[model samples]
Target: MKLRRDGESVYVRPMKLDDAEALYEMRTRNQDFFQTYEPIRQKLVMTLEDYRDRISDDIQHWRDQTGFTFGVFLQETNEFVGRVSLSNIVYGAWKNCTIGYFMDQAHNGKGYTTEAVSLAVDFALTDGQLHRVQAAVMPWNQASVRVVEKVGFRFEGLSKWYLQINGNWEDHNIYAITQEDWNK
Candidate 1:
């Protein structure tokens, strides 16, 4: 589903193919920064076509009820500065999802991500759609740990080899926020 999200200083919405150019520009500009945590996709340096193809798949995932992703844009310029998502959805009594996100390096530390995450979490729990949303942050990623914490995800202890990051086993601290926690 296409979601509309807004906060005091920013706007966020479901991503679209037309966003390829702006998204690519931001990724290219922050190549070195993102490379630290994410495996560098060679196609990122090629053309907007690659971005379009990937985002197209994500958009379809939304339609197919497989996942949800949103692009965070600056209100003043409508520039795509980041993305936040909830994937790995599970139905039944669980009704949970996994959350992940990142902001453009230049936009870091401006509280954009914190606010964006709050909005996304609110949307997730507002209608009782998800019972819980979880995140796994690498210990070294202090910034991400802070973001998830700011959005009410509490530390849930360490998970050895928690994620496959940069194509390797990586340790992480699992964090989670449930509808009950969010309400409180």
Candidate 2:
């Protein structure tokens, strides 16, 4: 619900409209990092007005209980280095949500993403009172695969056409950790 800061390296906080410029900047700079795995949206090429509209929409989604998106900040430089989120939350018998994230290319190998993801997962499983948190990683993304594994998610095999990544159905290996599983 609030943006949280962890020393001079990592910070996790709810996304804000004030974050639009930095977010857009990050996306623009890391175009290649996202182009292959994300939806093909020219939205990143938007002007300030377009960014405002999109940020408004992002805020509304979280307000409406659709999803929770957090900006990952590099506290030393106070830059938005990436984003981490819990989306597609389901209630009732399936109290779960999916974990997703990305880091700035310059910050890729420093273990910041993994550290941020670990914090997010802990928040989801503990503070958020969620039953399970899951992630679907492309098998080729060894770094991402390792991040989830390190955070306690167990490999659950591959799912064909699991997600519509990059505008086409893509196979993704499923990884998940239930609250009980985490406790174990």
Candidate 3:
């Protein structure tokens, strides 16, 4: 299932194996910059094959309804710009999902992430039919905070030591948008 949605400057779609090369390049180029915000997963540079394998798992996650990750690409140039995901989807009584994303450092402040977040939230609330979508950002990540805010996610509260990033527990400002909020 290759699902895609187009924005003026970019498109969001389920990443395919053939996209591995560009994805690998983007991740590698932004490796240092991304590490500051992301969790410490590994020390070695990930191989192209690793990205392919990861995409395979991500595709499975989509099919299983547990998560969905989309590659954000520059529409005009057809270049990889970033990745966004609605992960940890919960059904039944608690219909919700967690949204996460990262962009190549070179693409920062270009409205790509804001557009991607909007697309992801729209998909979760409208297409996926989830009740709520949430994003947690380190208090210092003002850029990310702005992204979610621009997408209409209201600040819910703060959680102390919510998640460990770079080996240390960090506080996160939680933000969310519910189905009702989306209807507005």
Q: Which residue pairs clash in candidate 2?
A: 3-13, 4-12
State the displacement of the C-alpha of residue 72, model 3, in Å, after optimal TM-score superposition: 0.3
Ranking by lDDT: 3, 1, 2
Enumerate residue pairs that collide in model 3.
none
List TM-scores for all candidates, in order: 0.92, 0.89, 0.96
Task: Evaluate residue 94 in candidate 1 and report its C-alpha lDDT on the 0 to 100 scale.
Answer: 90
Q: Compared to the true structure, candidate 2 yields what TM-score?
A: 0.89
lDDT of each: 0.85, 0.82, 0.91
Candidate 3 residue 174 C-alpha distance from true site, Å: 0.6
lDDT by residue (1-184, candidate 2, tens digit) is 4346463478888778898888878777888878887877755476666766766876786777667777898777778898898889886788899999999998998888888887788777776678999899999889998899888899989999987878888899999999998777
Residue 42 lDDT in candidate 3: 68
- Candidate 3, residue 115: Cα displacement in angstroms equals 0.3
Top candidate (TM-score):
3
| 7-49 per-residue lDDT for model 1 (tens digits) | 9877778899999898889888888888778754655565778
lDDT of 3 at 92: 96
Q: How many backbone clashes does candidate 3 have?
A: 0
Q: What is the TM-score ranking, best to worst?
A: 3, 1, 2
